[model samples]
Every structure is written in structure tokens, then in C-alpha cells.
Target: MHDAATPSRSQPITAGVLTALVGFTSSFAVVLAGLTAVGASPAQAASGLLVLCVAQALGMLWMSRRHRIPLSLAWSTPGAALLAGTGVPDGGWPAAVGAFVVVGLLILLTALWPHLGDLIAMIPAPIAQAMLAGVLLSLCLAPVRAVVDDPWVIAPVILTWLALVRFAPRLAVPAAFVVALVVIVIWTAGHGGPTGDWLPRIEGTVPAFEVGALIGIALPLYVVTMASQNVPGVAVMASYGYQVPWRETMTVTGLGTVAGAFAGGHAVNLAAITAAISAGPDAGPDPKRRWIAAETAAWSYLVLAVASVALTTLAVSGPPGVVETVAGLALLGTLGASLSAAVSATEGREAAVVTFVVAASGVSVAGIGAAFWALVAGLVTAAVLRRR
Candidate 1:
């Protein structure tokens, strides 16, 4: 007979595996889209996914084991959305890689210089959330657009997503991805399956800095990642009675991002939504034993990494909008959450709305993306309103 007082390994293990599965499936499409949007070839994008998985996996294992807590990590999905919006920069793919490296350095600086993190916190929450919502807007609309473009392929994917959202919210996006995979396979079989290296491989990029990319891609990527992932991640862990070692985490993730940049990854940070899955009471009755869940999740990410090459091949070679439809469905929840938070405070509503408008406009000026302009516009509006 099992003792009631003893913690069950299976509980944390199950929670951990689910966390990794949900985390990867839900946002990997966004990651691929982001990398490709910013000038990566299909091979480079696949490398990005592979390296990101490895970086976050190793980081999670280190953090969880060192802290003895379920310190979950994730790729920055909001940052990916920002990339999808930004498009190719002045120097193209190399420039984008440089921006990624710069973002990593910024994160590292945030760890070394406390005031850096403080400055990020100083950015009004409404503006930040609004910017995230704006970045997510177009991607979230892919399903709606896809319905017009290819109704048959998208319908089953959407139905699967909707069904899972109603019955098993946690599994919703992953199930949708599976449906998308099935559709891709069938479509590929009809049109001659995609030809590519089935095994995982890395395509390295030498970073090249440009003013436009630094301002447009790197700065906004840092802000979106820090605001959406790291800050919320700390809060989530706090809710579960675990205090994350902020500096240590930042250091690990920062270095990881720098390393991954060479292999085409955008950014890696602490997990927000999936953290709850591994840290919550569902993982185990004993708080001390919960670190096992994070460790398990790290391993699970490694396992998921094995499929990156195959998935990337299908996504790149499959019919147009099929993978994007799944990406759109995956981001729907995040879009809703960001929109809600954007206008939650009445005092900042106008500024937030301005930020959203500029960002969603998808306008670029003087080589700078709308995300940078959104911040500028929102801040100016907030200051003017304060004066009045």
C-alpha cells in the first residue's frame, strides 16, 4: 500500500511531460514563422528550433536542480510574434542574428545591473501588454484568413482546437498541431513528400549588427521577452511559493540566448503559462519534490527536439497556410490575455489603445519597426494626458 504522506514520482513526471509537450506544440509554429519571416531559409529556421530546444532544455535542468524548484523555461513567443511583424532587416538574416545576440546581452546586463531590470519594469504595463497584443494580432488572425484561403484543410484543425479547448484546455493547441500534422502528411503524400535531411542539423550564422535591426528587432525583442516571459514567470513561481533566483536565471537564459543566436534561435526565457503546469499542486503534494517536474520537463524538451527536423520539413514544404493556421490557433489564448490586460486599467486605456493601433498597423518608418514606434507613441500620449 502507498503511504499518503509520501510524494508520488509519477505525479510530477506526468506534469513535467505535459508541460514540455504543451509548451513546445503550442508555440513552435510561431518560432518557425518568426525565424522565416526575419529572413531565415527553411534550413536555418529548423536549426533555430533545434538549438532553442537544446538551450532551454539545458537551462531548465540547471535551474531546477540548482534551486530545487520547478523553474520552467520557454522560448519567447511574444518576441517571435514581434519578429513576424518586423520582417527582414537591413542586413537580412545575419543582421537578425546579431539582434538576437544583442538581446541576450541586454538580458545579461539586466542580471548584472539591477537598474536595467528596473528600467524595463518602468515601462507602463498597459503599453507593454498592448504592444504584445498588437504583435499577436495578425498571427492570431491567420485562422480566419486561412478559412478563406483553404477552408478544407483549416476546418479540421480549427475543430480539433475548439473541441480540445472545451474539454481539455491544456491539450488544445497540441491537439490542433497534431491535426495539422495529419493534414500536412496527407497533402504531402498527394504532392510528393518533402525532400530534406530527416536528421537534425544546425546551420550557423555569423552575427552582423545594423542600426535598424538593433533598434527594431533587438530592443523590442528584449522588451517583449522580459515583460511577457521573465517578469510573469517570476510572479507565477511566487504564486506557487517558490522564489526564483532572478539573477541566476537571467544569467543562464542570457548566455543560452547568445549561444543559440549563432544557430538561428531568436530568444529563450523563463516560462509563463507552462510554469503553472509544473509548479502547481497538480505536480505533487510536497513543494520540495516539485523540482523533479522541471527536470522531467527539461528531458522531455530534449525528446521533442528529436522531431524538430521532421516537423520543420513538413511545415516548410506543406501547402500554404496549413502550418500558419495551427500557429494562429495556438496564439489565440495569448492574444485574448494580452488584449484583456492592455485595457484593464482605465487611466492608461488611451495610451494603451494608441500603442495597440501603431503596433497593429504594421507600419515601419525610417527602417524602424512599429513596435519601437508604438512605445514612443504610447509614452508621448501618456505624458500629454498626464499634463492635461
Candidate 2:
């Protein structure tokens, strides 16, 4: 006889599938844009996307089954936004790859070194969120520009996203992506159909370290991924009565990021928003059974990996600003949340505002990007204000 606690099989599975759909469809364009901004070609960017999926899938599956916790993993969407804002470093793509590797190593260090983790935690929350908001500011403007530049192509996607957000908030971004995909299809058909090599493959890069890339890209990426994704992910799961295996979780994600970096991927970390779907009551009445939702999402990510090449082709070949509109729309929620958190507290509001302005300026000094400078500026301001 089935255990009395066991509920219907489909509930967890459906939640798992929805988790994957929302996670992938919502922010992939941002990933592609980030990789490209940091010097990846279309092929390399596609490879990065493929490897990120495979790596996170493998990590999530192992961790969820090992701990029997609903542990979902994801590529760092905030880190991607940081990249989109950072532009290319001194040594270009290889330098960017090297920066990615450094981020992974830093994550590993965080797991092994308690002090390192504590140091990250010591960073003022307002400053960190302000930095992320600054990084995302420019990308969030894409939809507005698209509406002005190509209203006909962008109007339907914006309308779809708005409609779904009202009734089905979780599906809003994915629905926008669907509309964008349909627009791409129609645009492609008119432009003589899709054209490109559609077979998914990993394009390897030999990482080359440079001081500018490390300080500019690696430091900010690590901070954003930790502050925005990993830390919040743990808290989200904890609210559901699950204590994530911190060491094991970090070890797995760190290793996964390291492995994916060689294949042109950026970073992978714990899921924030999507974790609630897999860990929440909707997955099942019994908390023990919720891990299945994570497992299911992992498998779903693998399936999506196969379509990396096709999706990359469509995004690249689509009408100008159309895919960007989708990417921008996808980040709006994140930007709003970050901005709210940044300015919500009066204690550090001045420091946080300074961070946001410096980051949004997109300034580079001594070859380092605004993200790093923004953090430095915020911390200094906070320290000065506290002293006064």
C-alpha cells in the first residue's frame, strides 16, 4: 500500500516541469547577451548555454537525490547582467573565460573557507543590491527602446507579458518568450526561413588571466551571484523547513561552474525564485517527496539543452531589437526587486544611492568596470557616514 503521506504523483512532477520552463525561457536571452557582450561569438555563446544546462542539471540531480531536499540550481542571471554591463576586458574573450574560472574558484573557496563566506555576508545588503540594480539598469531599457524602434514587432510581446503577469505571474516571462519566439518564426519565414547549423556543440576556450578581468569581472560576478542568488536561495528553502547542505551544495555548484567555464559558460549557482516552485507546498503535501520536483527540473533542463543551438540561431537571426526586447522584459522583475531592496532602508540609503549611480554610469577607470568601482564607492560612503 502507498504511504499515507504520499500524495498524487503528478503534483510534484508538474511543479518540476513548470520550474524548468519558467527558469529557462525567462532569462536565456540575457545569458546569450552577456556571453556575447564579453566577447563570445554566436557559436561560443550557444556552447556556453549548452554546457551551463548540462552542468547545472547534473549538479541539481546529484545534490537533490543525495540530500533528499528540493534543491534546484541555475545559471547566474544576475552575473549575466553584470557581464552585459561590464563589456569585454583587456584580454578579451579569453580574459572573460579566465574571469569565469576565477569566479568558480572563489565559490569553491567560499565553501572551504568559512571566513570567506562570512566576508561575503559582511557586505552591506543595500550596497550589493544597489550594485546589481546599477548593472541591470541599461539592459532593462531595451524593451523601452524596442517599443520606440519597432513597435509593431514589440507590442505583441509586451502585451502578452502584461496579460500573463496579471493572471499567472510565474508564466509571464515564459509567455513573453513564446510570443517573441512566434515573432521570430514569422519574421524568419518572411526572411526566407531559419538558416544556420542547428546541431548543439561545445566550443572550448583556453582561459587567460588578466588583472583587469579578475578585478573587473571576477570580483563583481562572484559578489552578485552570491548576494543575489546563492544566499537568497538558501533562505527561500529554509522558509520551507529545509536546511540546504551548505558545504555539499557549494562544492557541487563550484565544480559545475568550473567545468562549464571551459565550454564558454559563465557561472552556475543556487536557484532563487525557481527554488520556491520546487520546494513549496505545491510540489506535494509531504516535504520528503519534494526532491522529485528538483530531479524533474534537472531532467527538463537537459532536454532544453538540446535546443540551445536552435534557440541561439533564432535569437541571432531575429529582427533587430526583438530578442533584446524579450531579454529586457525578462529582467524587469529582478531590477525592481533589487532597486526596492537597495533603497528600502534609511540607514544606508545614501551609500546605496551612490553605488547605484556609479554602477549605472557605466564608467571604467584604470580598465576596471563600474561594478567594481560601485562596490568600492558604496563601502567607502557607508564607512564615512557611519564614522560621522
For residue 374, give model 2's deviation from the true position in Å: 0.5
lDDT by residue for model 1 (261-339), tens: 9999999999999999999988988889899999999999998888898889988888899878888888888889999
Q: What would the TM-scores of all predictions be?
A: 0.98, 0.97
lDDT of each: 0.92, 0.93
RMSD (Cα, Å) of model 2? 1.7
Identify the leading candidate in terms of TM-score.
Answer: 1
State the weakest 10-residue window (summed lDDT) of model 1. Answer: 1-10
Error of 1 at 249 (Å): 0.4
Off by over 4 Å in 1: 3-7
lDDT of 1 at 63: 91
Distance from true location, Cα of 365 in model 1, Å = 0.9
- For candidate 2, the per-residue lDDT at 51 reads 96
Worst 10 residues of 2 by lDDT: 1-10
